[model samples]
Target: MIEFKNVSKTFTAKEGTVHAVKDVNLTIPDGKIYGIVGYSGAGKSTIIRMLNGLEFPTTGSVTINGSEISSLKGKELREQRLKIGMVFQHFNLLWSRTVLENIEFPLEIAKVAKEERRQKAQKLVALVGLEGRENAYPSELSGGQKQRVGIARALANDPEILLSDEATSALDPQTTDEVLDLLIDINKKLNLTVVVITHEMHVIRKICDHVAVLDAGKIVEQGPVLDVFKNPQQAITKRFVNQETSSASLDDTTVVVSELLEKYPNGLIVRLTFHGDQAKLPIVSEMLRQFPDVDLSIIEGNIHQTQEGALGSLYIQLLSEHHDSLQGALEYFNTMRVETEVIKREQ
Candidate 1:
């Protein structure tokens, strides 16, 4: 397990001091994929660097298992670092080295026998599906393949934890998904604890079991992926979640609601939120069946799959000669564990 206890980091420059991370606290359980998400300058990279002792916190502690990484120094820090491996966004491989040689570089630093290193590298090559490319240099590989090499190298030391710092930002969407899936496979196969730092919400949605949302050096929100996605409390976090679902912004959604209200003055506009099994049920069809006197039309809707399950949101217009049934319909939806909000009622 990794714990960040009141951790904060600051950097001093000729200009002045900058606080890259604020008083943040987080716990990442072992064998699970955790994500730290934020925009540029949000201190996500600082957090990842601190994990392996590459950067020390200005205050508080970063502890893996029971060791406080911030206090370790010299040989102690180096030894502790060997247990934690890092994968970079740029695929930091030696251009002159072949795939097998690059993966063996860390084992060489540890003074492993050349033959043993070769065996380890060969095993890793197969683990990462780079079998035929073992003799190829970094230049000969695609973006996804290069990242696979980087991942294999990071695992050369058989580290317990792997830190990925914007590891997919440089890749195209398809390549990013490929790398992400590989990471998931590695996590399950090796039972390795993986921490990913990225600005992309899709990355979080795809693989992370838990997530921390950062903005301006402070964590605005953090929780299990499903809970955060279903009920985001902060404006920044909501924006990030919307980005993944391709949902409209609050203002834009309000404008849409207003236009719908103008077009159908007697219609009722409602917003529905679904979580888990609720998203899979045919709630709209049920509603129409229950209230045959009322006409229901979907204006806009989206359903997205996350690590937890399906999360969906929909905007619907309800029309009826009798308006009282709408309230009863909403109450029925509430009893079914679906969140219902009447955005606009007949006026």
Candidate 2:
């Protein structure tokens, strides 16, 4: 329901002009949690701000629900913003206000009746599992609870979409999972489209069905989360995926593979990646029976769960006394549709 077409944003600083977002085009489907991941200065935050009309592009257009958001201003933009809710890394709650008051603040700004606002706020508190904390101030709540209040306040106007900007970055791992589960529930129950911008891969892996990998103010890769994670085509994408999987670095794997090559010139060391039901295959055992001397040594691996299925990778040393047998095993791997790369031995 959101589209960015040839959108570019430039900032004029004393040093020079900076292109925060450059010719970035993307489409976010409705009723899905979409993630934009990048490092500090990758312009991910700028992309999300454009959705709420909080930031406008220097050139091109941003269309939300079929209307150009950049063309709106004043009352027009304010009215449109009500349909889009946002939560921040920090709770951003008014410390002096009680939980009920904070949740009611947005309603008050919208000029809802006092009694109606109170009732709406009460229901929201219950929705976020903070019913008894209605009277407690923000200072009394834990990080996760404070975020729940932020969520309740954001939903005061019954927004159709939610923008989460590093929503769980400041919390502990336990608290992060709690907040993520809450977001997933809210998305399903409310049928709300979500756009989450964060550097953490765990956030994307947990909830996002679609993802875009950003680097230097440009999108290097974008696709279904599982597909992107299974076979990353870009270096930046591989770096992030590897971080989440915590797979041993390619350099380290290369070192071990190189040592094996020195000992056995005829052997081949290949990296293999398996996904979905393929992970359960008895392919390795079957291969050993077919070629008695072919040895498969798994150096490092991990199984990552995505909405689609399980994805696993392994580095193996395939040993055979003859070159013909080694080539035959490589061909067998190709037939299984398993991704494999030969580790070239240095001359």
On lDDT, the leading prediction is 1
All models, RMSD in angstroms: 2.3, 2.2
lDDT of 1: 0.91
What TM-score goes with each of the models? 0.94, 0.92
Q: 58, model 2: CA deviation in Å?
A: 0.1
* Per-residue lDDT of model 2, residues 1-347, tens digit only: 99999999999999999999999999999999999999989999999999999899999899988999989999999999988999999989998899999999989988999999999999999999997889999999999999999999999999989999999999999999999999989999999999999999888888898999999999999999988987899999988987786467667766877888898787788877788888889877777787787877877777777667877777788887777778888788778877777878777
Q: Once model 1 is optimally superposed onto the true structure by TM-score, how far is the C-alpha of residue 3 displaced, in angstroms?
A: 0.9
Alpha-carbon lDDT, every model: 0.91, 0.89
For candidate 1, the per-residue lDDT at 256 reads 76
RMSD of 2: 2.2
